[model samples]
Target: MTSHWPQPPTFRAPIQPRQAGARNGRFELALSRHGARTHIGRQYVSYPFHMTRPFAFDVAIPSLLTVYQQSSSGGLYRDDRLDSRIDVGAGAAGHITTQAATVVHDCHGQPAHQTTEIVLEEGAFLALTPDPLVLFPGAACSSVIQARLAPGTVLLLSDAFALHDPEGRGRPFERLEAKVDIRDAGGRLLVRDNLEIGGAHLSSAGSPIGDWKVVSNFMLVGAPDRLPTADELAVLGRPERQVVGITLLPNGAGWGVRCLAADAIAARVIAEKLFVLAVSAAFGQQPAPRRK
Candidate 1:
């Protein structure tokens, strides 16, 4: 019998865009005043931002306003996978949104994972307002965001997810897990939200861990003395479609809002509206519009 040789260990990789220009396996978006220049794979993307002060330009490709889908997958964890990360430095202000909904096809055999990490420096403003992340049947994915903020900076962030049938029939059972950790410049955890949803944990006839159709977490960080008032709470807590709760932090780090909805779109829309209200309240004015 012939001897079998052991195979070498190989590092799992991120999904490459169908087009070109990508950096470090992700559609790298380095914060810039004139929006962000996207790197498809190795080549620099052609799209450029318009530019808005107080609000820097954002980078998303295949942008909804521009290109199509960025990458294609073979299946799931087996081969085809979509993964990305964005790094925002101090004094940067911008919003990162996807061109459209991010849909993950069912992996017949292997589960796929999509991950994003956004790191913000002091005095930075980030609004991650992309479309909902849709997971088809048999899609298994996990995402994480590690945000490091400065003393006087403001961070506006949210995460939304949904699961539907890959065959286009209707909704199917799926598992979506997400985690967000906001830490100070010193690497201390200021706030943490961990959400895990799946067949077992999701309530059907008698489950208890989760019973809502969709769930989301929205966070805003600013100076403590400049918090929202009772009137502001009345306006924010008044969503006709979903249940939302807003609470101020005792340590002055910021405020937290958690909402659960029956659909992902509703969750996203609420998150954006809440962000706008929270920012306006925190800054004493309408936040700057995102530039090119």
Candidate 2:
């Protein structure tokens, strides 16, 4: 497969053996601040992965670099595996996102898997927000995130998923499983979040999701003094189109929010609100709206 990314500053490939027809791939990047701008110091992206040049569009955080990741493949299939890693150096700022939602097609009995690892140095701030994964009928997928952050590091991260049926039928996806684990610089696990939903559950009477079509989890990880209070977070959502609740992470990594929305737009609105709040807390000013 061809890659769309600009030539990397530093690139290399390992000598790992591969199996025929295997779609396994991985990409790693390290970002650091130079003067007032953040730039990628190193990168290694393999097949099925492509990304656009970094853009600094947020006037409020001019140093913030934004990268849009893409996959050459149309969507995930049976036995597909993808892994990616990101490192933010001290004092660096960056945001990583996808151009569109990733579609997970029917995998029958073999599910697709994706894992991401992120590292943040002291004083670094990064936003990891990607479009939700859309699961088609009979699709099954598993996703996981592992983050190791220094004490002063800050992160505004989000995870979300939605279901779809392309044949005009009301069938739900087989299942979707997701997990997020946060750890300190010393590799001590602070907290973990797990989610699993089966399509059959949604079709049953008294479904836990009710009428909601999207599920989202947002986290603001940083020093305790920089997090919002429970009362402040309780006022984050409205009575229309969604439901949300926020509370301090019991292990004190930061704050965690659980949001359920009728659609992607509603979920996105809540995510943005959390971004704004987190930015104001970390940057000491209101951030300019990020234009998608």
User: Residue by residue across 145-205, what tens digits does model 2's lDDT show?
Assistant: 8999998889878888887888868787777777888899998888787766677777566
Runs in model 1 lying further than 4 Å from the true structure = 1-24, 32-83, 166-171, 207-212, 225-233, 237-240, 247-251, 287-292
User: Weakest 10 consecutive residues, lDDT, candidate 2?
Assistant: 1-10
Candidate 2 local lDDT, residue 193: 79
Cα RMSD of all models vs. native, in order, equals: 10.5, 8.8
List clashing residue pairs in candidate 2: none
| Highest TM-score against the true fold, candidate | 2
Q: How accurate is candidate 1 locally (lDDT)?
A: 0.52
Model 2, residue 131: what's the lDDT?
Answer: 82
* Top model number, lDDT: 2
